[model samples]
Target: MTEIAPIAKPDRNRPEPLWHQAEQALRGLIADGTWTDGMQIPNEERLSTMLGVSRITIRHALRNIEDSGLLRREHGRGTFVRSSTVIAGVRGLTSFTQEMAGLGLIVGSRILERDEQAASAEVASALEIRQGEPVVRLRRLRMGNDAPIGVQTAYMPLARVPGFLALEPSASLYQTLSAHFGIAPREAREVYRVGTVAAEDAALLGIETGSPAFVVERITSDAIGPFEFVHSIMRGDRYEIRSRLHI
Candidate 1:
């Protein structure tokens, strides 16, 4: 175990709260490599003594860091440092490839399962198509720098995209859709919620079962109509969804 030095005392004259100042100091340690990834951080008691603050303040600072995906807390074990989360913008209908590329990450995908199937009630509802309609189902493991980040399963009405099954496996389904059927996504709506990773998805993502994850349901439409429905399980520790609001 590496010894982490104590944080500097926050300026009492500043307007910043003690917890906020502690959080910034901790983050600086992470940024400067004082705390490396997967290294267990000092406990609240030790941190409080080092920073000359209360344990409550230390807890608040750790909570903020854990929420930001830079640290993960285990039930019995102490918090551990982790890589910074990958920020995904929620402004447009960008493909996974485009999103990863924007962050300077190498995007990759492994096709887990691909087959033509009848649309279920949920898929039909999302795609605005009749039940039992032919649909192409694709299950893929989305990767960043060859590390698994998410598991995505997409459904597309086969009636509209003929020969889609024959196309080569691709990291960007949007590009495949455009190249094969001249179908470009014009808009997309997504619903996000926090959830635990299931056994199957956890295995694929190389995380423990019941780990925190983000469940995203997306419905995308081209100029013609809704064409794709996607269900994604994104690793909460490795990804963060960001959105900007305009007044």
Candidate 2:
């Protein structure tokens, strides 16, 4: 579980309404994954204290957020963050961590496999590395709100990301790569297939065998060239891809 960040106090001096600033501060918590799915939030009074605002302002902000489908208010109960869909933009090159965080979902990973292995022909082709070259492989069971969402296996050239095996897979791989290895993906090509989940992936994702799934293969390139190849099997019921069309 991630630490929840404290809500920032709204500035009364700003031209924006106090309720609006309070609303944006609360929304910022949701957007950054601090206020996660299905989690009950502080009461209006508590929120008022935290944000240094009156209960009335907090109430107005909470009502606006609830009306927008970001929260649910139950009678005699507290407001809870809504369990939102795991959505990704079709045109974006985003890591699973960033994608989930944007939707206020805390992403968790159960490491299934982590080892150095010889690159398979397909992986080598995708990464533009020689076949049989050493590669670092990390396989993870991806989770949201403690529910299984997908199984992702990523491969990178061992030479490019040395000592990657030592880092915890719970953190974002792309962030680690950029911070430690100075490698960042600039472009990505993804191929999505609608298919039935295999027994292995189904077991990891807590779904029945032959359940519908989206099989995605992605080849990502840094400044030098292709460096990462990833395969993901996402539960069809839990994931969605959105893209805005250009007219």
Candidate 3:
């Protein structure tokens, strides 16, 4: 276990709250690699004593840091520094496999369910298909470097891609679509929001229910028309979204 050095005492004359100062100090430790990933950090009592602050202040600081996705706290255990976030760029029309591969992480998928079903109202609207039309539904647990990172459910109109359900379980959906059907995603629009993990998805991602996560809803289209609708829940502690904009 790496011993965390005591933080400097926050000046009482400073306008910042003690808890805020403590949080910044801890963040600096993480940024400097003093606290590596998965290493247990000092407990609240020890931090309070070392920093000359109340235990309440230390607790508040730890909670804030944990919420910011830098720490994972376990009941009856201790807080551990989590891995750095995987940044997803908004400019790409890439699949999860492509994105993770670019970071040199091994990507794996476990198909939870796949079936041909009538499209629901939401799916139909997103794919620009008529309601009750046949669609191939795929639910998958997405893994990066052998660690579960997200759960994604995708719907595609059956008319657009026939025989999709016959593909191998572990094959990349995008690659299969491109190679067989010549359907490639040319553009995608995604909306991102924060939410607590639902029970089913939490189990699939191996996280506690109610853990913070990123909810991404995406609609993908080719030059012809919209064809795919996807909803994904990414682990907040392991992923972050990045976008570049030109002024």
Maximum-TM-score candidate: 2
How big is the positional error of residue 91 in model 3, measured in Å on the Cα after superposition?
Answer: 3.1
What C-alpha lDDT, on a 0 to 100 scale, does residue 167 get in candidate 2? 78
Question: What lDDT is obtained when candidate 3 is compared to the true structure?
Answer: 0.84
Runs in model 1 with CA error above 4 Å? 1-84, 244-247
TM-score of every model?
Answer: 0.68, 0.68, 0.67
Tens-place lDDT per residue, model 1, 1-247, is: 5786657987878999999999999988877779876889888998989888999999999987775567877889878887435676654669989877765456888999999999999999999999999999999998875678999999999988898888888768888888889998899998889999999999999999999999999999989899999999999978886566899
In the range 136-239, model 3's lDDT, one tens digit per residue, is 99999888656788989999999998988887765488888888889988999989999989998988888899999999999999988998999999998789
Query: Model 2: what TM-score?
Result: 0.68
Candidate 2 lDDT for residue 72 = 76
Q: Relative to the unseen true structure, what is the C-alpha lDDT of residue 175 in candidate 1, on a scale of 0 to 100?
A: 83
User: Candidate 2, residues 1-247: lDDT per residue as tens digits?
Assistant: 2345677899989999999999999988877768877788988888888999999999999987875556877888878876554665654688888877765667788889999999999999998888999999999888876778889999999999999888765468899899889998899998989989998888888789999988899999999998889999998877766565898
Point to the candidate with the largest lDDT: 1
Clashing pairs in 1: none
Which residue runs of candidate 2 sit more than 4 Å off their true CA positions?
1-84
Residue-level lDDT for 111 in candidate 3: 89
